[model samples]
Target: MTMQHPAFAKGHVAVVTGAASGIGLAAAREFARLGLCVVLADLEGDRLEAACQEVRALAAGGEADVVAIATDVSRPDQVESLERAVIQRFGRVHILMNNAGIQPGSSLFGPQANWDSVLAVNLMGVIYGTRTFGPNMMSHKDPALIINTGSKQGITTPPGDPAYNVSKAGVKAFTEALQHELRNTQGCRVTAHLLIPGFVYTALTANGRTEKPAGAWTPEQTVEFMMRSIERGDFYILCPDNDVDRATDERRIAWAAGDIIENRPPLSRWHPDHADAARDFIAKRD
Candidate 1:
């Protein structure tokens, strides 16, 4: 299907981090298929090379249109180098998908290593990528997109995986602020979007499972939804999987906000004292 977003025009350059697999790889392939030059960034390894080949096969211009860069987005220097490399090869970039992220398991007081690594890659990576490439994108004065991958846990702040939740929550907040700044800036055409994906069966979420879960979405499905949302100019591209629909997601998010508004305990949806009340609230329709 043809994309409606102006920035998706053919010949435009699109950079996708974490493109070695999952949602990031899916998005990179789609861009290549759409005739845009694609840059796939991930840690240097067989996966990155293989992903580059996968995307290259779909690229209209073949090998010349697709390249892979080994980038540790958590490092500002690497992120800056990624920008320079892209510019040197492609001249200009029109679309940036800051989708590099890691979700190692974490406890509330987990090993400092887990927390640090998660935050550095998941949150700081997005920050470094945006700051490094955003200025030139704006200077181009062409329709462009800055898509930051977020998560549902960021919005609802679920109990498990506190480090993951905190990192994604920061992504949500930072992308929001970035969008606001982009919109208010004079003569700026670059737009920021937060891509909040549902349970997608990726390497990151495999958790040793050999087969795809019935309730999860494939990365392609998630990317298709994301493109449609971007075409519609949606800032919060909240995706639904096989198990949960948009209505249910909306209710859950509202209830999360209600915790503060109603003066209830944090994450009251899981709190013993508020379980029944939260269930009843979610059950009611508008």
Candidate 2:
């Protein structure tokens, strides 16, 4: 199948969740730069406004359009309101970026609230966004895309933050399933993509960091990579950072797969006896 261009036409509408900061904000800005009508949605009202203003300023003297909506992605009512706001403002949505997420670092047997909140936003948010906007995009004959932001932690199943990991894992699985179903649908024009980003310093990880770490990539860089992947018709938009390359990421992911394929203990990569083997596996030249 031929891949579509990354450029958003002058009147096309793009909806982005978690647009207050990080990759979501970067994508919104890039969409506006491409002359698309951009809808920025986030839980933080002030930050959302600021991001929308920045996008508008960047589009000044251009035909790009921008709107900001304060939304809690976990709440179905709020997500519905976001869709209404977008349609009321732009008449149609051509792109949907399911990027709203939160990382609550709690163990599997830890507090229930953390798991609830993380799953509600990370997993349910993507579900709601797709369910709400997917049919509209499908009815339109024009090309449309749904980008779901997942995580490397989700695919690798690391030791810490089981709640966050599970939520992202669900996103990965759901996006893949959604894409398969969409491709098989007789007249569907909507496509789904899983965006797996590597270590990037953002508000989610801003507990005490004053400067970006060496291994991290900027939100702009991540968005740039995402746009390129979309143009390439990549369903799994796995991104690498300053410290890790695609090869390293592939090895890590393969090791994770081996855990299940070989029926080892959960997260055997972090097991004391398996540490050396895991390291060797990750460092092995292909």
Candidate 3:
């Protein structure tokens, strides 16, 4: 399971939030396989321990290396404690991945709890992780990276799940600012990135389903794409799932942005009145 990837070099240390499952766990395994001492952080205690074991099994050079910390990323204190523990154990963190997220269904008129919970985890979690680990990494001369997981829903502003979309949208805005600041800071070696995943078959998107839908991409595939994008120095890693190709994604994104420029009904692409026009626009692009 050892991956000989150039994105993460040997002897480096990485801290990945939401490492208990899904894309976070998959990315953590890849980092460990590449000879980096990885720290897995997640809220699920049992799942975090099990994920650590899996990552340990993939260690290229023996000694059972890896640590699992139960952390609630929503709380600043917990995230700060996780950083302290990582530094205490591993010395320095070269990679920080704020991948913890929750997909609570909601609409414009949804309960305040749903909005609060989603924002606390998806948005503030990323903010806290960056604010805590980023400064120390910047002080070090070693090259480092911080990846925040966002969602396509945030960009397109599609129908349904408005709360989830809003939180992720905040992530997009915050990470963009973070990257800009990192690039401008003198002697800083860390860079920030936003990961926008399409329909991925993860626990968050499973919705109680036992089987994976054909339209969804597996965690492995998503991480592979992420690594490739990172190697290209991509700030926005927009991933494509099984049902959506790059071209289709581009068209959708363009149309979404065009909604403001064209002054069409909000989300008019989905509106019955604009269905024909939307299809025509896509057809012309194709």
Candidate 4:
């Protein structure tokens, strides 16, 4: 597994948001294993400390460095502070993973707080993190990577949890525009990537469950998949878990596109009238 970018090499730095656990922590650990200096930020202080320790342990004795910060990604000042602190410590940042997210339940007429919280953290956090770190990365001579964590729901626009879907959809659009912008900018070496993860066994998705369901991939597995995707220079790093394959995901996304192209109802796959048809569509072997 050779590193595709210098960011993955020793002495470079990688910052991961929501790194206290799950995919973020797994990414940080993997970076440490690659000997990159890793900085972790999360809203949970104690868990962030534990994660920092875990990343430290992953390194061969004195092989890499880890920094931890208690950060609320939704706030601009906090995210800015995180960037400044990382720069102050490591001198430069070569990789930025805006992976912070929250999933409080929401509905069509749910409490206003749910929607507000979801948008602020899930959408605005990625926006702010990208804005803060992107320019600095572009200024440097090193090749840089920016990975914004998106969701499959963003593309498919599922029926349940409208707020979550909306937020992730924003991420998808923003990352697309970001990659385009970077590509057109002269002397810009930074590449933007959208990581659409499949069902992963993480705290946000656990819903108080003690065991990982069969369909879910571990956080480490997800990050490993992400690395491979990055190496391929893929803009949309869509992941498939145990329950779904790439072909299934492709069919589902094409059907979602058909909702507008073919004049079907929005999110028709989940609608009652379209259930059988959607099932039949999914059942197609080809």
Per model, how many backbone clashes are there? 0, 0, 0, 0
- Per-residue lDDT tens digits for candidate 4, residues 27-80, read 999998998888989986689888999999887544348878888999999999
lDDT of each: 0.95, 0.88, 0.89, 0.90
lDDT of 2 by residue, 173-196 (tens): 999999999999998878899999
Ranking by TM-score: 1, 4, 2, 3
- Listed in order, each prediction's TM-score against the native is 0.98, 0.95, 0.95, 0.96
Q: Tell me the alpha-carbon RMSD of every candidate.
A: 1.2, 2.0, 2.4, 1.5
Candidate structures ordered by lDDT, highest first: 1, 4, 3, 2
Which candidate has the highest lDDT of all? 1
Worst 10 residues of 3 by lDDT: 1-10
Q: Any runs in candidate 2 off by more than 4 Å, and if so which?
A: 1-7, 60-64
| Better-scoring candidate (lDDT), 2 or 4 | 4
Candidate 1 scores a C-alpha RMSD against the true structure in Å of 1.2
> Which candidate leads the pack in TM-score?
1
lDDT of 3 at 195: 94
Model 4 scores a C-alpha lDDT of 0.90
Least lDDT summed over 10 consecutive residues: which range in candidate 4?
A: 58-67
Residue 114 miss distance in model 1 (angstroms): 0.4
* C-alpha lDDT of candidate 2 relative to the true structure: 0.88
Tens digits of per-residue lDDT for model 3 on 1-286?
Answer: 3443343888788899999999999999999888999889998678888898899888774344588889999999999999999999888889999999988788788799999999999999999999999889888778899999998888988888898888999999999999999999988878888999989999988989999999999999999999888887889899999898887888888888888999998898899999788878766753
Q: Compared to the true structure, candidate 3 yields what TM-score?
A: 0.95
